[model samples]
Target chain A: MPALANLTSREELLAEALGEGWRPGPPPGGEAEDAPPDLLPKALPLSQVIRVDYVVPGCPPPAPLIGEFFNAFLSGEMPEPGYVFAKVKALCEECPRTREERVLKKIVRPHELLPAPEVCLLDQGMICLGPVTCGGCSAACPSAGMPCTGCLGPTPKAGDMGLAMISALASLVRAGEEGEETIPKEDEILDALVDPIGTLYKFGVPTSLSPLRERAGVRGSSSPYPVPYQRGRGGEEGGGR
Target chain B: MKKIVIDPITRLEGHGKILLYLDEAGGLKDAVLEIPELRGFERFCQGRRAEEMPQITERICGVCPEAHHLASAKALDECYSAEVPEPARLQRELFYDAYIFSDHLLHLVFLGGPDLLLPQDTPKGQRNVLGVLQAHPELGKQVVKVRARAQRILDLIGGKAIHPVFALPGGVAQPLSQEAREEIRGHAQAMVGLAERMVTFFHEQVLPDPGIQSLLLAEECRLPTHYMGLVDEEGAPNFYHGALRIVSAAGEEIYCGDAREALSLIEEHTEPWTYVKFPYLKEFSWQGFSAGVESGIYRVGPLARINVAERMATPLAQEEFERFFDHFGERPVHATFAYHWARLIEMVQAAEDVARLSEEDALTGREVRGELSSPGEGIGVIEAARGTLFHHYKLSPEGLVEFVNLIVATTHNAAGIGLSVKQMAARVVKEGELDERLLNRVEMAFRAYDPCLACATHFLPGETPLAVEIYDAQGVLKQRIVR
Candidate 1:
């Protein structure tokens, strides 16, 4: 597991937050061997021969949380399930990022990382998977956080690849790029949001506008992209550049 | 000869077709096995952020999500030049073990059991596991209990019984608790006992009987063929990770080295006749099939892994491993029928290893992983139930993925399987009765690869071939298409 910590689990969060009251308690301490905190926490079984144990996190939660949860539970006081364990929480309620529309004529880069609380990026005329993304990490990116990059996979209601929601978000961004307060025309929005490569063309105005190619629309292939793109500034070759 | 056709063999994952062409003179002309489905899984991954692949690729196959997750993670690791730290490595090992354990359990008691215990010609109503229960109630109960236990483990680790999403690019997304660890330990022991009983069943009551064995043995399902698999640090069949090797039918090392080199040496070619692509050494394209240790095309999977590995890591498996080799000698067994024996031995080894790993102190720990500070690539390979699976990828500096190529277990044996089918067809089919039972037997030989047609053919199911035509010099069709 990576050094990243997960505050996703109810037991792990309860032990770490054990009365810490809102200060985001020390990144939910536990062993490092647990799960990396970046995505949904899930337990990794000891082996096929043994029956698996369900940890509060996804497959396996952060190691520290696992240890802490173990200690806390072993200590006799059962760690209460966190918000997600409540059985009635919607994904939006769990996410820190809100959604609303605010038209913008230009693109925002990583340098302009400043975030406004309460107002959503889509509403502000920006592209984001935050609202539509699952918030097991308490909207980790937007909350403490960098922008939400959807580590929790997709939100439960979002459907596979969350095509419709992504399309809506991209169209909203395109409308803002066109300097129009509202998307008065569907064809113009579609044209504005297409990717240069037909590959992910289905994913982008319908997806978003990378600053490098504003005219590039999202292609709708099963593939993530036509050409692999490295993420951020790392030299690593990524499917999405 | 009577015509027999088992149109679609039940209990295997994915879709495939088999055809047997016989000449008017009662000689078999060709036996073709075709896979006809494409999911566009890897192709759809292009342009998407690399980080999304772990989950995205999980959708590739519901039957073996762990295989893709492990392979995808390795591919991403390669993209970044990143090596997973020690703790992360241990954690990943444990994580993968959970998946393998669950999957094997699924295959054996669930998918493969019915065929082993029930009569092949038994009425459809009594051919399934449920039917077995009515005949052998105690064994059925044991199988159900084992399945339930395995499912429990899967639910805890992957959040579901089918597709598990526990693995991530750098490491795992979750960890284990002490209570969970102890439960797993208990289960592991019980499973070992069950496996012992199964071995007895195979030896005492199964293998020596009438039915599939006589025809299988007479038909010579044990011929020598080439084999390939991964070699661990200890030079054994390390199922989780290792190096690649290609061994001749006589058990001599042919090609041994890193996976990337293997990739460069092997070429993939598409044939419009089948959905699966053909893979072979660029140098050995025309060797064709032969009766003996011909440098002809061959196969992979369990028998191959057992042959290439110096020895077994577990005690019981090592004992059984010796007996396995003693029967076959140095030559590679080309007979597709031997795959079951090899699979059983590997299963025994995997079970024993699970028992040992379960008791290790490292199995229960708090510091399961370390911090990732570097941006690099990480490659992971494993000897999946089918064959050698390779996962290579490049991750961006910020921890997102860039490029990926998951050469699955089935893909490695694609060309070889096609060749095996053709060879078996040529030897069988004496009278042009178009024997369905013989055809099914030949098909099973290829299915031993458990080829994932989607992964092998770049995720596209080949369209149903209308016919394969061969013409004489006079322009008359030499062979007409027949059902």
Candidate 2:
């Protein structure tokens, strides 16, 4: 049971038969490593090695948080240099917006709400991502205290991800048969993204009614929601609608 | 005499069923598993909110969605008492080692090497993954280049690789880019030379094939029972998050703690024929059985995590774990074919601790996270790839998450793997022989416990034909059904 040319490399066989600790580059940066450049984006690649077009988020992001964001760009700490999708387009300048309400309705479900710290969840009336998203979630859904499930997917001024999820579900419905300054309709953005089709397709992204069914060029069933049941049986229950 | 059924077995991810029976002195009696299907994701995450359950329970497993986003953000950072910062607990153990390196490279290249490199009566259009890329095309291009370098470390910390959303509680809401740590340090040196050629193609082309080592050295197996996982405070093998121990068959350490007292010794009943529920071990819920060896709930996964680890801090996986403490003695190795030698010594201690954290220059970082706060109940256990997966959650003094239980390691070996598949289908089939391919090779050795079933929900529904009765050595009675 040996020969596949006797095998070895789990790092040269645990670095020469397992003393195995390791550290050729990157560590030091965490306690907000001297704050200042807070708004994010230094794009290190461990000491300027390259390929910085970044976006990778969704939770499993750890390996010591990419080795402290590449040891804060190998210590120069350059965050402001832009294009990490423009620091998630300056999360709509710490968002708060209601600027005399842009077409209202009555919508909630951002995990139901209560905490609202720096405000904005679609301008306090809820449905938020602080004005069309991106700000490295530090504004953590109005500041932890919960709501921006954007999961940091889209934010270089939201050009797409289904037009900022149809402008955050036409700013969470209620505008009525599309009027009070428009938006809402298309069956109220399919009832604000069908109650969460597993958090609107977890992180696969795509949405905005999948390019309006590929700009009306229909292909059929791309799951604009529905079909919740069926998953690891034994304790069955349902409801996505 | 012959009756066997596979039901919903193909390409393993979820869904279940296995049954087999026989008698009249020809031999082999009964065995049933059934798990019919009902992912009540803990009653659809009861009443929701617990930090929106780590992005709604990372859509519970498209095969270990980062173990339901690290047991739902460590049960909403323990139901919101949220401390979470030592750089968000070392970036949640480096994205729980890229969710245990793309779920043990998608179960050794697409669910247990397509029936050990395509054959066991092959034809199902050459048995899948394009018949493992036309039989080992360089192990299917090194299993899609070690799952695209474990999907660039799950797309640099949960943006996506299947279902990630940067597990948040007091940290990780997307933060890591030194150009995604030099493309995860050049895909961790090409996944340490494709995990040493997949540990030499799992010990030479799938454990020396004689139909896969006679279902991995079958000595009328199903071992000494009772073992569980997620160790750590020194006990070793801690997949991510810890506590919950339990070990016995003499290795000792009977039950450790935390994981919300995993419903005080896991129970879960119901079996009006099977949507898989059984569970057991509430002190062997009325134990009654005989088979030549003592049995009451034989355990599961990584041999219940190296028999509930009390050691192993990595020195070559602690010298290959002191040769399994003197090769199973004081009543232990009751052979459930040593769950493939405890899944190749926990896949060579997860490829030697992911090549010692990919030669750590602290694995490149940009201050991952901090400041975490807390508002109450929390739990997170790990060791996934099927086994020890707790989660718990409770929260609400304003933090949100009201409740969510979860458990799941196939509901703690569903009643000791249905009493060792009814004592190995009553000692290898014969009595009125019903063999749906030897009960789907005894439910692919109880799917080497890769069971998730969206983390246990307790139960319901059943009765889809599958009958099989037998009794006779003058005890007369027979019936075999699948239709």
Candidate 3:
């Protein structure tokens, strides 16, 4: 079996299904005028493949976890079927640092400031996805003084990791004494996020609910943001979740 | 004419297939290793921040993520024209050495070792890591322990054993802590001991075995091609930093200079059947891939590195290197199986390098990062565990990546691998009697190169179920084997 057998995108699954004579048509309403035709019959994750016995999560699963999995198999003590994931559901639960809800005056990139060793990176005004990302890596990035970028995909219950991260960030950004008026503008928040899709969906875009477009609805229609994420534009349109 | 397809070649990285064309008499005519996967990585890279390259590119291959990470990071350094600080350079070298030790150990013990250790006629079910473990538990323990120690060293410096987040544009993202340094030193010491044991085991157990020794020097496995690797100013084997060195088939140093010149000296040839483009020296003017000293094809990796280098950097590995030359009786050893021996010697050198670098005071210094400037075009070259890897990038002034051209180690050896498969298939298959053992022998020829097609072909996630089909002269399916 191939190493990445259970980690394919929805489109890849549809292509394979189509090769096996699973014909697919466009979505309802003849599809959006600007959107590509919906070749995917359904948003079926690769994990749902009948032949898939187990899944070892992580952008690249750590060596020790793999060693343990093999050792278990060799010892004839098989893990339960389905997702053989890390014990820690979310990166925040595995992080060694402290976390407390607080307002931020401004967001900062990782290189801008040297973070305190034992403070929550998100609390330090850095855009870290520890709270929304699936853990079991022992908070490797945060422990090394870098912020977690959700490479391990999403928590088990989170429908979309990127959307969860956006909601988390929105709630964390506190308004000044002037109340909601002092809060950072949506554009300002998007600018601070910089490549929000790339950051939040770094490794899980294919598995995320909003693999192509965000749930906020079609862009340039009624949304304040007129354009979608375009490659090589350096986020000039400020389009993100 | 007849065609036999070995689809989804296994026991190696990524997806690939081998096509063997034969005459009506079942005599082999030609063999081609086809890499049918392409993920459009160059397109994906466009519009990404130059700084995110190190992180994004590393995801290309799970087996050699560190190589991609460091190569991408070095490219960023050159793009900004940033001078890496002393401590940062030392840290990068240390991290790279650890990766070399761990990756080489994996190939030697698990991937390639089983073929050399077990009998050639070993049952198909017993020709894998599990079989080796069942046969020799003590050796299995050593393999696990050494790999774990190497992983610890990588985690200590790189932040994670896989997809590490330490490298930055000018330097490493984090400085080494005193405690981490001490831990790494301890692991490095243990690693050196393990490497020495592995070398001794190879000499005593494998070298003396008449069957294995004969197979190592088998004429069917030999391909007299040129060699390419990175060597220091003194012509010593240097994995982290060095100039590109190319040696002709006759062991003459034909080209030695910076990476840019080397890049210009080579051109790529694309075949419609495969996504991988065959790269050959331009001086020969695209004669196409063939067997012989004048094939214009060059191999990279352990055997090529040792063949091209003047000497190993460390004393122990250098001593072993002399013994290797005595056995081969030549400067450029063309025997394909010599790759395993060269890989073992390199593992020893990497272990020694880590021990030496860990004691430096600068390794623990706080000055890890340097300033970055506006982006431009740059090329970064480094000797990955497999061979010399190149990452070329063009970035906009605002630091967004405009273009990317990556020549991974496996891509350099694709032509050589195709030749090897052809040679082995001709020798093993007769009268169209393609059994499990005969088919495995063909796979062994490709596996010896340790080609990571995932990195070479830019493949994406999917199932790779191998299917072998033999077609008769009239294009009628005669036999099919599906796994």
Candidate 4:
């Protein structure tokens, strides 16, 4: 927040060009003094808490779209309330990779291997969220040789992004662990899958109907300090990250 | 007695604050630094997979995600006991070079630079990056553009410039194409040129000013303590990969070891007033907030790296390194303000080395990632732009993360930062009065460390957003200065 060369969300080009974005961090550890003791709060997107008038596409809506919003505001041509300022189609519409309509035999975690650049991440066995996510980021992550983690939020299909992703993944992956190349029985892929909830609901959980119930039970740690997200939360000393 | 509060806070208490207690004669009797917020991260990171850590943990701070990403990847490597391929190491290091280059340039030109670049008496509002840019548009614009170009390199490789995702256990995810390497070299060459010009700017424009001279000679914030940094095999300071090295006030070696062994060498002590824990060398034990070779107090970041290492890893930086030592005429430079100069030297090193790393023949190889085994407990350490960053994890048999601990750069420098604040406050406060000078000196004192204050400033509307409230012995408000 220093004054020197301080660039806001508007000024940073990567954010504008690619819709570069992030998820909400955990709630602050300290709370308001006058808050009710029974206030059991779980992290939820603001749209869920209130009647959202209109949705801006990206986590931080990109510049052109922001410009569109303002132009609409100035010209009094604003879209109907409750509308999303993004494409109705899925993020796959913007993806540049090739999709061969192939079934996946194994699940490849992000770290397992170098993803093939020209092939679709989903087609290459990575659980890319492109099919379920809203388009607008121009497939930035996919183009950079990584899978989409859905920072642009859900499409306007009025369905949970994670659940939709789970259904899509179930259809593609076969029943077997990694390194197995055999054709497997139908709908048996669920047995081979692990951490479905984590992989699926990473960003969408805040807005998902099937939000994590385990978060409540997992709220406090045995250590009492509950130093969760140590890397993200525990940073900012010398350079003030 | 009088109490002067720098950044008096109530609701937004997480930002850095200073409490100066003054005697009747106006000399400070005692001083303290307070930061009032921290939360639990270990609780949430436990149930996740280790492979996702580089991506997840990088979200902790927008400024230094690349540091966390690389460090987490290294910890994952240790957890799985994978020997990384030479090509992957080159790729990660090359990526890290751009990160350090960009980050250091940010601090020197934008955050800390504004203070030194402008005159001491410059109005608070005009002393920021905007003020500096308006005054020297060419220098300011060029630095900003170059900084972005460096991020462009990160974007090309890390997949996300701010939140890099290239790193994974044993290696990186993205393989550099021949085209990408060539592009990186072009940008890095431009960056190297800019860094050298800035170094010249530091000499001609900054060093001659009496304001800077005072800051350089100021005894108030001089802290004589242990220094910690990462040193390469040749004992050259390296930001990406090296063993942790700790040296004493008189330049004596104390401890040199890998990240896991570092866990044993250091101990954490917590205060009842704050959640922030003070870490000290376990060998000497915790001996209060005072600093010295005998006490466990240790400092990190640019000054520490320069002090702890034998030489800089690159040529131009090594030249500046020799000049830095000659300027001090001492084994270790303890002057707090010297950190600014040291940081510029580091920037020169980062920019110069980025070009070298870009041209490495192994940079574009196909074996960018290697296979790994089952996860276990492991530790990883790297020098973040701020200072040394530590990440440790323990995994279950199912490969789910079980335990997590991190000693971030801020945590590493907490004790020293607090001590410096107190020292600067005591030196500047005269006769129980709150004035402009106290704000300037105190600001520079902590800004030396480039601390990430958790406090929100936008809520307050003023030229200087912070309000320093002075109170008497009876806890009555004596005077309030908003600057």
Instruction: Provide C-alpha RMSD values for all models, in order.
Output: 17.2, 25.1, 8.9, 10.1
Residue-by-residue lDDT tens digits, candidate 1, B1-483: 111222343455655555455454556555555554443343334445554465566555656666676677666555544455554465455546555555655555555555556665455456556777786788768867865665566554443444454444455443455786677777667666766676667666667757546524544455566677877778878777777888877777778888656766665555334445455566555354342356444466777787788888888778777876675554455556566667777767766776777666765554422344444565666666677776665555544445555666676676566566666566556533333344544555565555565555433223232233333434355544332
Task: Tell me model 3's lDDT, rounded to 2 decimals.
Answer: 0.76
Worst 10 residues of 1 chain B by lDDT: B1-10
Interface RMSD of each: 23.6, 23.4, 11.4, 14.6
Q: Candidate 3 chain B: minimum summed lDDT over ten consecutive residues — where? A: B457-466
lDDT string, candidate 4, A28-53, tens digits: 22113211122123433444345567
lDDT of 3 at B439: 79
The candidate, 1 or 4, that scores higher on DockQ is: 4
> Scoring model 4 with DockQ, what do you get?
0.13
Per-residue lDDT over B264-324 for candidate 4, one digit per residue giving the tens place of the 0 to 100 score:
7888776533435678899898899898878898988889999998998899999999988
Off by over 4 Å in 1: A1-241, B1-9, B123-125, B159-161, B286-296, B327-331, B364-379, B394-403, B423-428, B431-439, B458-483
Candidate 4: segments with Cα more than 4 A from true spot = A1-86, A102-104, A173-188, A210-241, B8-14, B22-27, B453-464
TM-score of each: 0.65, 0.32, 0.85, 0.84
List the TM-score for candidate 3's chain B: 0.97
